[model samples]
Target: MDVIKGLLVLACAWGFSAHSAVNMQQEAKNISDLSQSMTGSKEALNTNVISPLSGGGSLKTFDRKEDFSFSIGTCSASEVFLKILTQPQSSGRLRLLAIEQDTSLDGNLDKFINVNMDADMVCSNGIMQCTNVDDFSTCSSFKWSAASDRTVGLTRVGMSELGGCYCISGKCGNALAWRNLKQVLTDVAGGISASLAAVNPYYTMSGVTVEGTQATVTGGNAQCATGSVTDLVSTTDPKKLASYQNDPNKMKQDSQTETASSWAYQAIQSGSLNPQESSEIRRCSEVRQPIIDSAKLSDIITLDSGTGGVGYCGADCIMLTLGTVGDNYWNSPCGEFGAAARFFIKDYKRIKSAVLEKAIFDDWIQILLNGNYIWSGPYNNWTGQAIPGQCELSTSWNINPNVSFKHLFNKNGVAEFKMRVMVADAGEGYAFARLTADLSCKDTKTDTIANSCSVYQNDPECTLLEERVDGVLTFSSGAITGLNPLPQSKTISQDSCQITIQRPWFNKNRTYRCNVKTQSDLTKAIARSEKIKTSTTAKDYQDIQFKNGGIVGDSGTLNFDNLPTVQPCVQACKVRKPVYPDVALDGVDKGVVNPTHYDVTYKECSVGVCPLSSGEELVQACQCTNDFAEATAIMQIMRNAGQDMICSTGIEKPL
Candidate 1:
């Protein structure tokens, strides 16, 4: 390689310095003349030719140990430079043998001839070098001596300069090696075609294109150029790219479907069409409800009675004094027990806002709607026991309309207002409460009508006469005209002229009738008297006729049926039942802490749809479970203390 480089540098220097003044056109003509003399042809030699294998211009190759020789001129002083340009089209190094001559006449080389080999030559001082091969900026010169005969030899070998693999016959660098290896492996394996069949497609080069210095090979199903052996191995097989065995999207879809199917199956097994209410006993219980601030309250109404023998005494005065009373304090019939008094607000839909104006009680009194706690006060401590020496206690609270109506009112628009009084050691039991609210109602109406018509015509005229009648019919009341009457004519020779008007009526439930006026014109009448016949018929109007505007009909009554009045509360509550879950305690053990002591359990009777004030056999009203109630109370306390907590269904926070 070093020797080749030194010789290339020397040849380039000699080419530029020796032929710096040579005429390019004259040299080309001389070469053409020499070529014609040697081949005995008139045409010029086409030196600018591209090789099929190398895809480069003026490419020539020779095998190793082959004798190669080319002659330019026969011992001429006027030297001609036979410029040859060589470029390797594949992965290999190019080699050129220096020209030699046998001047001693002993069949041995004695002198070397200088030849120009560069496409572009630059000269500085006395040295010449090739700057770029593609730029043909200067022509090269070849010097021939009369003392020696010129000879040239070129050799090309399939070997890469980068020391990996070399391309052969315009093929990819490793293609031939891969083929030979595959054949050897096939022979060793007793010609098992299946072992190499999968890899055979990738090794086959479909085609190659050489553009300038770059060579692109299309292989591996001929879709794209396989840049390297690694690329071919990675991209050829589609099975290695993807698999559906652990797709997360498919797994998630399957899990959701299974959950829905399980819920549906459970609903079916429990004999309930709705999955949420399946195998669950529903009863009225205290549950938190969100308040809507947009609803305004007006038209205040006061209640006078409540359950558990509690009644209104007067303004701001309510008492549960059914058993015995002393010193303005009522005693419970049972000692050391709890008594509950409930006030039902049946007009819950119309009532927008409710407020407990005042509540006076001895012992401990807790006011609630359904099961939601409204107010509890004057307790001895956090245990909710009655405070000693506190015989009379009073506290007022405002009720949230949304919370009150959601749990208290069933689908039938009835609400239960309750208050529980606990007496410890049977001292005294007193309950006094007052509630005021607002109610509203609205009404609507509609009407419809159907009308039809029938007409009878009679005409008496026995003459050759032509009669034409024309007029417009008008209605008295605002009624939609079904059809209008058109003009009619007839020619009566011997019989009477008769005209019938039918299928004309109005379409509203109103006292109205169509009045018709006819003006008969006689044309070409000869001894004839034509009597035209016409009549009007309607549902609630007397039939009449006139020549001009006048009273031509009698009025009758048109009755309209009114639709039932719609209460605003009913419309609001109807859509509420399907979405809201039934207000019921979860279970005895899960909801209430001490069920035996409090005498509270999950109600087994029907809920929302049950009738009001019925016995326990039909429907039962109950309080919310202790755990949920306590959780709500604690959350409320935390919010009041500026540490707000998020409240959700079926979620309990430790107090």
Candidate 2:
């Protein structure tokens, strides 16, 4: 064998071994451990809690001023607003707020402390400890220490010192924890802290914008003005700054600044913006950023590279093998290709009506069979040859002319193939088959079939029960009309079963059923070979919920059943008129449009918040504020931050 072939063989072996060794418990623990400290040592900032995968035994701690610089970055404003979700793993009083350049909190003991913590401690033996950790009324402190020199000469009292704006206490227990915090803090702050935008004057705009610019904040009352500060260097990584995954259904876009600012607002207002909480938020942000970014890619291009499994055959890599449809003798043949058979053939009646339309399907199948693709299996050549019982070829279709599959992947430990082909004897002139041995499913509790038949195969259901009885005789009137063949089944592991549809369009129709099944359930099988988009996590759903104003109901209610009014802020901000070629539709050139020559009766300026229910209707009788653009952008940020807005007054007016 050639050197390339030899290398491929070795790589495939290692991949299989690695995959076989993956422990689900370890994976969950890895994520869970990120939020809590495992080290038995005292809570000091800057302690590195290395994960087991990194070969470290120490528990990771939050960064401190000793180890990191606490100064905000060049993107910071005079005041920064933040919110924090408190987890109850190891509840303790947040000590110093170290303005660190990095996360190491050693020796930078003169950091900003909770005003309450600072007051309660009384400096016994140079050690500060909380006298009453539960009484957080005095904890609200967003002040720079006098030692820091920023406020040395200023006589202004901090917002926390003012009456009415009290500190937030304890962990929030709302199922929609993010939403509840808004009310909890508002009531706790006595409406003094309505939102982060309202409270924090030194809000940083770093890594918040699509382009990392501070959004224009025009005429809103400054709740706690910290005065202007030049661009400071943020100690934390921008990627791990905040949870940016907002509900696309509610928020206009993923504004990172809004998320970061909102979180900071909550933290400061709630008096939870300390070293420990900051570090935890950073960790959670790091864990969640990739998942959110992946979900945003327009076409899941990373997974669906538009190539097939044959790419593995790269002339030198011949250890990989592919198989044809109906090859029952091909035992676990490394990799195989399959698709819904309906793709290849056309019914006579539909064909005669739209031969041109059916031709598109033929083109797609031709690309699949002719495309240079590789199978997803071990890179170490677990199996040899390009196709079973055939010589290695870049085009697998050259070896087996009449078969095609959408993608190739391993099912269980065995290579399961899906075939889409035009069969002369089949009634629909097409046949779809799942050509993989049915290894006895040991744990039916965790095993689930993809049930793709409802959408792709045009069957009532795709069930193993039907698969078992496919050829069984069905006598409906003591006469045999035809056999009821079982539809194809895509087995979904228990891990992939956590959902109700995400991404609104995924629930719209069956346009991408086959791809969704392959990506979600058969992720591991195809991930190495293809860019399979992973499923969203429970945290993703919460982040999305919080982005979309967080499922509001009657205050203090347990359920999200009673939703708030769907205010179409986008509609409220749009300018309604007829079309004009050279004129901008945003309340400008309204009188310039030729009414008689308009394509649509009412030309809509799709600018602001449009309710999902109204579709495209223009919000009637709402007026724009003087700072409409700024208000619109800020409102989008606030709405994305889960702040409830009463939009009956239009974009300019804030309720």
Candidate 3:
């Protein structure tokens, strides 16, 4: 009986080995099919499958017959296929532990998958045996043999438990679903790692004030400083008047005579005085008014040199002197001297001409208008001795149209009038002047159209439509009502039966007549009639219309059935032929013995041609006739396929 039991045990052992081999073969076939579907070739299953080993060389596996292996490079349906080999256990079951490195490449073995399998290396009951779908747990004790490379190893835990092993490195697992989930998680983790690595944490925030939906941001570098005020004053004091009598070294003595005045008057009359002479006159006049008065000159009186003393002149004239002291006597101190006085002409624009009549008890005098020498006295010479005489002179100046002097006036039409006096030997040192100007001005009229649309109908704003119809009908008076009025009369003739109708304007009479030889002719005329008319009253006629026939007047009523109506002519379709020497048929040659046609055809008749009116130009109606349907179809197909798959007509075949 012991011998019989031994035989039975041996038979059971052989049967069990055979069953495991079949299961292994089936699993290998499944992996091969999956790889074939994904890589499109059976040879790609084990191609380039490598993993780093502890000793520095790569361990290439994933072959159908390899023991304890997994595929890392290829994935399908977000899952990876792994085949693990194990020894038979006493309970006919296997417990497997898999650990994988973090997909983030942090050098940590954080992801793990624990699985249970049968002795035949098949998952338990053909179901997923992984405990966790996608869970990462700390494995601090796990360390790689070589830190430089991702090494994978499978070590047997004990002699009795042969299948109990650990896959010590880089992504390894036995559950297909868990492996696929790990692949997806790995991609997500990689993206997150990249995103986190790209972030910059050193940016600074500026001040922000939020009020309701508005936000005001005040940013960037700004600086502030204290404020102060500055005052500008004139360098020269007006109260201290300069004169040769007070300071002989600082001021020059004026030397004038009758010859100088005569020469100045002759130069002005001949228009030979250069700009230098004019500038000199202005300079001498400028010092006369130490502080020019901008006020308008009214009835001038005595001129005081800021000394609070009256002059020798009366209240109707202004007195000027060379020093700060006002002259009390006409025959003043005996010395070569001069005086100056200035006043502003505020209404200079209205001043057409000015005449100065001066009564002087002095040697010579000159007048300047805004720095230009306009007139001078006759006794302006400095060579002769003083002649004690009351010299009276009258001079006039006018604005010449040929020579514009308007620019001398400022924007406010203000001008300065300066008068300078010189005493050769100090016989008399005082002078006075009376200026009378002829003021003439006229009122100007300006007319303008505020809104042009009210006067011009062609203005864009007057038109109701944004865009105008280019070819539509318009009235002869340039009025466009966008309407097509019918003809004023109509005549119909058939088989010697004539009918005439006249349509006049509103409140006009309607006239119609029919000439026929027999009833047949009348019936033919009625049948041929295409239009119907209407009237507001029996006497007064209105517009013509097309409707069912009715009573015309007390004369009679003409009614007919099945009236023949005019039918518009059908438009002729346009045909377009493909242009020769086409790009699509670049290589085509008609002279070749055997030529291929690339389905070249004409385009549809209506593709590039519009329905033209009775008088439209042919060029305007049809613009494009070179586009072919077949070429267009070919180009569209090629574009959709993302490749130039069709050969041209003229391409030569290889011999």
Per-prediction TM-score: 0.19, 0.14, 0.16
In the predicted model 1, the residue pairs found to clash are 81-142, 307-342, 461-496
Best by TM-score: 1
lDDT (Cα, tens digit) per residue for candidate 3, span 1-655? 4334433433333344433655655675677555443343333322423332222234444443444423331111111111122222333223333323332232233444343332112210121122332222222111112122322233222111221112211233333223222222222222222222222110111233333212222221111001111111111321122223356544332233333545555777675355323211100000110111122223222332321222333322322222233332333333334444433444444433233433334445454545675444454342234433444322221211122234454333324444455443333333233333322112122212233223223333222211111111122223433222111223334332344333221111111121212222344223222111222222222222224664332222222222233224322334333233444556756576644232222221132345333333343233334347857998887686644443566564332
True-vs-predicted CA distance for residue 269, candidate 2, Å: 23
Q: What local distance difference test score does each model get?
A: 0.30, 0.26, 0.30
**By descending TM-score, how would the candidates be arranged?**
1, 3, 2
Q: Kindly provide the TM-score of model 1 when superposed on the true structure, using C-alpha atoms.
A: 0.19
Query: lDDT per residue, candidate 2, 304-414, as tens digits?
Result: 222122221221121112222232222222333244211122111111111001111110121122232322111212233242232222221212222223233211122
lDDT score for residue 154 of model 1: 19
Q: After superposition, how far is residue 343 of candidate 2 from its true place, in Å?
A: 27
Model 1 over residues 4-111: C-alpha lDDT tens digits? 443343333334332332454456556644443333221212332222222223323321223233223111111111211223222222211233333222334355
- Model 1: residues >4 Å from true position, as ranges? 1-335, 342-344, 379-418, 422-427, 430-441, 445-655
Output the TM-score of candidate 3: 0.16
TM-score of 2: 0.14
